[model samples]
Target chain A: MEQSKKLSAGILRNDRLMADGRTIRYYDTSGQNRSAKDARPVEKQPAIGELRLDPLVNEWIAMASHRQGRIFLPPKELCPLCPTTGELLTEIPESDFEVVVFDNRSPSLRPPTGDWALPDQVGPDTDLGSAAGKCEVICFTAEHGNAFKDLTPARVRVLLEAWIDRTAELSQESFIEHIAPFENRGEEIGVTLTHPHGQIYAYSYIPPRVEKMLAAANKYKTSTGKVLFDEVVAREIRDEERIIARNDRWIAFVPYAARYPFEIHVAPLNPVADLTGLTDQDRDAFAPIALEVMKRLDGVFGIDMAYIAAWHQAPVRVGRDVLRLHWQITSVRRAPGKLKYLAGSESAMGAFIMDMRPEQSAAQLREVVL
Target chain B: MEQSKKLSAGILRNDRLMADGRTIRYYDTSGQNRSAKDARPVEKQPAIGELRLDPLVNEWIAMASHRQGRIFLPPKELCPLCPTTGELLTEIPESDFEVVVFDNRSPSLRPPTGDWALPDQVGPDTDLGSAAGKCEVICFTAEHGNAFKDLTPARVRVLLEAWIDRTAELSQESFIEHIAPFENRGEEIGVTLTHPHGQIYAYSYIPPRVEKMLAAANKYKTSTGKVLFDEVVAREIRDEERIIARNDRWIAFVPYAARYPFEIHVAPLNPVADLTGLTDQDRDAFAPIALEVMKRLDGVFGIDMAYIAAWHQAPVRVGRDVLRLHWQITSVRRAPGKLKYLAGSESAMGAFIMDMRPEQSAAQLREVVL
Candidate 1:
């Protein structure tokens, strides 16, 4: 293997291929050997999921039936995210690693096969397409018991670098439209794995949410000659009440129109279209703020908040300049034991009825000191 | 008080004003005495929620902060939907009633209280408007420990008549745009009260999902000179593989692109724009099919399947002819204990990655001999 590149913040990156033709990568604080051979036999990759255009919404819905048998809250001893040690072989062949990312065994999307299906056969006004792209799981640590907030600053910096490198590499794929790096933390959010990990989904098409944001951004630009996300950041900064933490490069604040009970947005002070555009300084500055926001979230209700921390980045093939990168952390936990579920109105109608006001939630979050 | 009106299918309807000036209606299989005074003291009405335009999606999000402390899984004794006795008082004042519909105490939307806020002051590109409409709860049965599937055919017909009556009555209000009568069943779907109840939300603006459907329907009409929903039902009938049940008046089938693990769509064979448009014969025919579908859903896992049964009806004033009324029942339960949670892809990006195929789910439902 070629010499490992010492990336920003003393992080070393080494890439490898798995037995099933999936890519795996390791990021280490210390430049160490991560090259390990897969002991398990090569297995046939499952068929790529089928994407059908929903006639009602004119949107694509992925049908990943193979994922039905995927792991669900597996015992810690059989956790696939845990590093392999002795007889306990896992997804990672490495005995130990600071950070590791591997292709998901049962992915919603995967590398396309040669075969393709026609649209007419799927259904009326429905077009069949391959769920082409990548879905990777990033394990923060092999220890598996700690939360992302407990990670050291150096570790978080390494994770951020890993995210940037992956985004840059994944954007090269001609068909990939958006790369989403998100973490579904806590069982309340349906997180099956207790390990402190996240997922990266490289979608073949611009997702619905991102598409809507792009349209809004373009509209805002046409109307006001200013970026929509930039205005949002400026407004939050001016308000100051919702601001959780801020530095020269990054600022974290609860959005004015939060859909969730506990929702916060962390964005760079300067506009960055995607993670690939983040400078070393930007990455360094974001780690502490992100960590602090997560800590504050946990402090609220004195428990680990079940949240979906999603990185909203500009689509790779379009809307790069107008759309700005931001991390949205939305928790459904309304109170100590209550969860705000997306029921009839929210689930079926896509009209969110927020239980708490954003200003009140921000005040509560601000009161929780790290 | 006015004499009870004998509605279609021998259902009796009696309307009265609550202590707080909210409307309450009772539906009975027989024209019985439904007059019972609310024993509780008059309570102050909650302030109307604010409607904020979510710039990203161009959608209105209802900020109903007053709903934070709403009843959540109340005990059987404190069940608000239960019939009030001499010692117990509930939302339904009548000591004995077949089925009742009353205004929600903690509503997402309500009649405007005349104190309206300005738009520009809320936020950039955000509009502030009163959540001016109605939110009502419909008790399916007087019993607190039974599912909708367990309701008798007579009771189901009465419920259908109530839905039809409410749709017609609520549509007369100038501010009501769409009336959504849906049931969030089981604790899994966040049904706060276990009193076998459903809810009707009369929204001032068209919901996001309904708007998309309307746009698609209009586009389809312009392109093919055909209504989109009618074509969907026709296509499903022709395919036959996804059909779960069919009768002369109504047919239930799984959609081509179902976003949930167990999703079934029930549509009238003859086009009906909304519940108000349903004839007496249509209502009678629909009750049995709807009940059977629910029974099969429960039998799929031999347990009460938590599902969201939403009525997708035409808007009050627009697209009444082109848009068809349909019932969409979506269950998150993937297996006996597993649920398909909206995690990273779904919750964050509005991209659904379903674990089950429509055909397979339909076949399973069809196999259940109910």
Candidate 2:
């Protein structure tokens, strides 16, 4: 395995080859020497999936049938994300590690096959392209019980630096168009693993939501001759109603048209196109607010609310100047005992009917003590 | 309440006013006389919600905060859609009826307030308009516990007729741009009621998904110089692997790129633009196929699969000639106990990673003995 040079954040990066010829990396904050061998027997890698174009919606659907048999919620002793112990061998070969990232065993996308053909017809005749990209899992800690919110400020900063490095690294791939680092927490959100981990998907094409945002940003820029991100931050600061928290470096607010019961968007005051563009000072300032927001989310429902925390960044090769980087956290839990499911209207029509007003949600979130 | 004239079908339409100044209608197959009076006391109607434009996605989100307290999983005795019995005064006033259509007590959209303003800016200043549209509930039968698949062919035909009548009627309203008739079935899909009922949402603007489809259709026509609907149906007929069932008037098949675990699309073989364009023969021919498809969905897991059955129709004022009418039935049940929840990728990025191949799903559905 080829190892990259260490980053400037005092985190050592050790890369190793997994039993299935997949790349795995370990980020150790203590600068400890790491083992680069896997004791598990080698196995054949799963075949890469195919991407089929949905003509009606002008989107691509990655068909990964092999993922149906992926590991579900397993017992603690059988957890795949945990570090290898004396009796329990896991995905991480090391006995202990601060943080680790590896290619997913059952990935929706894979390395390019060098045959990229777009479907030419509107109907089903085996018109598909290779699902060529990368999907990697980033473990936040070796101990399995805590969440990203429970980590210390230093640990959160390390995680942030790891994300920034991965984003920059993945963006360099010619075929990858979008890089998304997101966390799906809690079993209610259909998280197959109970470990505190996030995933980074390098998509072959710009995702549908990002594409729409880019178009909107371009339109806003053309109409007003001002950046959309700056305008949004200015408006939120002026209103002060939906704003959840703010500092000199960043602002967090419940968006005016929130689609979920509880939704928050965190944006840096200094405009950056993506994570790589963030300065070290900007990264250091983000840790506390991220933790505070996540803690507030858990406090809202008196439980670890099932939510998706996604980073929306500019596309790798396009819309760099207009699209800005932000973090969106959305929870589907409408009440303590109820969840907001995407049913008829939301799932089919792509129209959202929010049950909670953004202002009320922001007020409730603000009332929570961290 | 004003009653519209009767149609050629002998389904007598009795329009009545609810206690809250809302409209309710009854469609009787036997021409039974309705009481046409509400026994319950009048109450204040919930205020109409607002529609906020989501500038990021160029979509409108209806904010109906009052709907948070709407009815959830109630006991069989308190089933709101059931007929009024001796001590149980339900939403339906009469003791017996074949079909009933009524205004939702807690609707996401309602009649406009005549104050319609598009947001001038792109940020959080309450740039909203009245949620101006109608939302109606269409009860398939008066029976307390029965799925739509259990309904007789005649009952399904009556329901189809009711949908056609409602679509044509709602299309005439200048405020309503799209009419969607959809059903969210099974408790796992967050269905509040167990009764056999569907919903008709007359949206003030074209829905996000429908708008995208129309754009794709227009683009396909411009490039190929052929109708996209005709091309799709013809291609599906040629490729027999994904076809589940077909008749002279309709064809049902799993689409080339399916997002859900078990998704089937039923398209009119004659290429009708909307439900209103369907002929009597087309309406009569749709019943058996609809029932068979629903039964196969249930048979897949040997349980009542949680699903959303949605009607994709052309916009009322535009895209009538380009967009074709289709029925999309998507089940979230990936396995017996597991469901395919839209988490990080699907929910945040609008990118779908399908667990099952469409061909395999079609094969499984085709093997079911319905």
Candidate 3:
């Protein structure tokens, strides 16, 4: 159960004047706790950490004194994004939303009316304080235990349409630079909410990792006169070793430099930056492939699978025409029951070694007649 | 239940001739399942997937055509690593000792193992094959429910000692270039095993990701005349944010570019490569920190937290002591029941957006009095 007791959460201090020589922040933590849920606006709490603005990277990192300790392990089935409610929570999107998407708490998700929970002070920045960018939830399905794999191919097409619709709508925000849509599945992945939902984060600036990949792609183009991914994909197709599944639109394969043990990348035959370029048919086509991919995953192991399917597209408004878009799915269930702990190497140094061969994985998937 | 109808284990065609063909493989469809609890020498069977050699990477991958439709999920409680009784498997290490390291029967875990349950056949390169390195399993505990996290700090310390000892011992191998040790926890992370244990993979190369990180570190050093991590730690200390705990010898902080939401990095104040440099006292000191870190983590969530505490040390025989050694502890738990999914940004483009402000998290955690 999430914390239903919402204290009077409002920031009281705004003294930006130089207090200490260092960039120290002082916040008041006095607030009233109210168990009642109201439709009133919840005051944002005080910022405890410094949201250092990394100009080059152009992002905000939550640098707080005790954050290291707070990065606790996740639970089985509770969503942090949900509003404070009695055991019965409200949904998102105040509108009779097909899926909950709301600036205000959804009726089902909201608590009964409560006294104004106002706090004495709040942090310098809240919400991973990017100074810019929007973070919101995208409910996948109303039912629990539902996933991208469960929907019929046509229904999955609707999901794709929703994705494109949201991409276009969110891209319209002036402050938003990049819209990232992704989903996490399975208890091992530490999913809080069992509800079938994913999230979209639109950042104000380009992240460093994307920058590195883009730079690499650009550099590879300059030197090789070809997209590195294209070359790599061509080579894989030529070898026919690591391909997990495929269609005219996409080819799913294990990457040569797989960070996780079971890594699957879905590269489109046609290169596009974001979902902006994806046609209705292309997305429709993605339905069966996506569902089949998920089912194939289930077939590959006979058990429900877990994976993070990230839609890697170009940043918003940027002319990333040359960059090829792809879907990267990293599964944590290469072995059964036991997880790959990421002991000394993979987590620390970014080094990875796949115990299983990609061809073997693909062959296993190929056997599944989804 | 595991797939009782056994597929061909795996066969190795390791030789110079393996490279001649565009791709080659051997298979073990029927093999004996050996229990890690007991060791027995048995003739193993051939698999459907042949072990193909990657010339450029100098590694062996499986070419199991039969596995196309095979379930990719691990069976519940039935470890492929610990088979009870079946046809003898193939492609295992030749060494006959107190404990033998063999290939996984599933046909892609390093070198590919065969079973005694089925008839076995030798490959073309079985005699002339040159293996990249060794893949061995260390059963941390007897009980299936107990994992490294469940083990006492004393037991964890023993595991750490095993890492050090095995790393040192394996580095001595003439053919090995890097010794990578990691453990994946939870099925969500694609872990199939229920047993509490980790793996040590001595590779013949410095993986691309490690190379990339090293290159970045070197570049940062050249520009700032300081170690990148040290400077980051200093900045974190000065900011009084992201720091979880620190003692005279070690400091733990959450990196601003945290891929996982609640990811913490534990590093020694002194610069060194690999755990070999740590004194015995330092090793002893690690036990409590490990316990405390985990304790604080458990305190926050009040659940069996799933985290990856990976040790990132310098490469085994690299000529330079370039990157400082560190341990990264990553938890995907966002709120109590919610998870931090590696959806779009982090999984695909390598970008991350943390929802919680680290300072607030730290304050919340610091106040917990762990």
State TM-scores per candidate: 0.96, 0.98, 0.61
Tell me candidate 2's TM-score on chain B. 0.96
DockQ of each: 0.73, 0.76, 0.13
Q: How many backbone clashes does candidate 2 have?
A: 0
Q: Give, for candidate 3 chain A, the lowest lDDT window spanning 10 residues.
A: A17-26
* Cα lDDT tens digits for candidate 3, B1-370: 1112211112111211111111111112223333222233442433333334332122233233332333344453344333234443212221111112223333322332332111132221222132344555554544446655466665555556666656776778665666666665655454545556566666555644555556656766566666655666666777777788877777777665564556777888775678777776677677666666767776776776667666666666662455667787777776666666554555554555456655555655555466
Best by lDDT: 2
What is the lDDT ranking, best to worst? 2, 1, 3
Query: How does model 1 score by TM-score?
Result: 0.96
In CAPRI terms, where does candidate 1 land?
medium
**Model 2 pairs in collision:** none
Q: lDDT at A269 for candidate 1?
A: 84
RMSD of 2: 1.6
**Clashes per candidate (backbone, < 3 Å):** 0, 0, 128
Task: Encode model 1's per-residue lDDT on A1-370: one tens digit a residue.
Answer: 3236667777888887777777788999877887787788887777778888888777888889988887788988898888888878789989888988888988998866664333433226565777887899999888878899999988888888888888988998776789999999988778888999999999988888888888878888887888888888877787788888888899998877789999999998878999988887898888789889999999989998999999999999889879999999999998998999999999988788998888899889889967
Per-residue alpha-carbon lDDT of candidate 2 for residues B61-118, written as tens digits (9 for 90 to 100): 9999989998898999899899888888888888888888999999999977665434
For residues A114-207, could you state the per-residue lDDT of candidate 2 as single tens digits?
A: 7554545644234788898899999999888889888888888888888988998999888889999999998888999999999999998889
